[model samples]
Target: MFIRFLKENRYVSLLLTFLRLYLGWQWLHAGWGKISDGTFDASGFLNGAVKNMSGEHPSVQPWWGYFLKEVALPYVDLFNVLVPWGEFFVGLGLILGVFTSFSILMGLTMNFAYMFSGTTSTNPQMVLIGIFILIAGVNAGKIGLDHWFIPFFRRMLFKNTEKEFPQNI
Candidate 1:
């Protein structure tokens, strides 16, 4: 019942728009700060995550730390570019309601990555909001560009008979 309401209700979509805007702004600010500073480095964070695996509490799991140490740290240079730009693009996609599902999923992936690295901060809250947005599905972006863009693409991609596709597509 709750999921149905979230997926179909117009009022819920309004609420989701506000949530999307807030979450999108948060991501945009973080990314823009890193990009503008131009001194962003993931090596420090990756090393810290690996170090966190040794403490008594062991905030980061051993497997995750190993991955960070071996896979991530070795490609720190690529992360230097990917992280900031990925965040920026995810934020833009969410705000514009372009590829809304993909944006939320990518943002969640980043949130989980940060949490796995032992940094909590506001990631939990962001992840909760992102979950709500994802649950809302197409309705979450109905008021934005997805309203027009989705239908256009559907029409273009499914060009066939005179049959009309459902608006939910």
Candidate 2:
């Protein structure tokens, strides 16, 4: 019953759009700060996460800990570049509604990753918001750019003309 309302309602979309904007600004600011700052490195955070692995109530999953120790530590430079820019692009996508679903999903993925590393922070709240945005789907972006972009892309790819695309009524 509730699912029907979420899937069918207009109000839900408005709520999701609001949520998207809120989240977008957050991501954008964080990313932009990292970019503008003289120095920002993932090494310290990764080391802290690794140290958390030995405690009785380990915050990070052991597998994640291993990945951090081996792969991420080996290439902290790559993560240094990826995380900030990734956040910025995700925020831009959300703000523009260029790829609303994809952007929110990626944001949710990052939220989970941050949580796995044991820094709770605001990630849980962001995760919830991302989930709502994901559920809202097209309507979440109905008021934004995707309304025009998706259709245009579809027309271009599918040749959605009466003559080129056959009617199936």
Candidate 2: tens digits of C-alpha lDDT, residues 1-169:
6655655578887877888899999898888999999498999999999998887788988999998999999999999999999899889989888788899988888899899899999999999888877877777787689889777766776785565532210
lDDT of each: 0.91, 0.85
Q: RMSD to native for every prediction?
A: 1.7, 3.5
Point out the worst 10-residue segment of candidate 1 by lDDT: 160-169
- Model 2: how far is 129 from its true place, Å? 0.7
* TM-score to true structure, per model: 0.93, 0.89
lDDT of 2: 0.85
Runs of candidate 1 exceeding 4 Å displacement? 161-169
Tens-digit per-residue lDDT, 1-169, candidate 1: 9988988999999999999989888888889999999999999899999999987789999999999998999999999999999899889888998888889999999999999999999999999999999988899898789888888888887798688777664
* Location of the lowest summed lDDT over 10 successive residues in candidate 2: 160-169
lDDT of 2 at 139: 74
Error of 2 at 152 (Å): 1.7
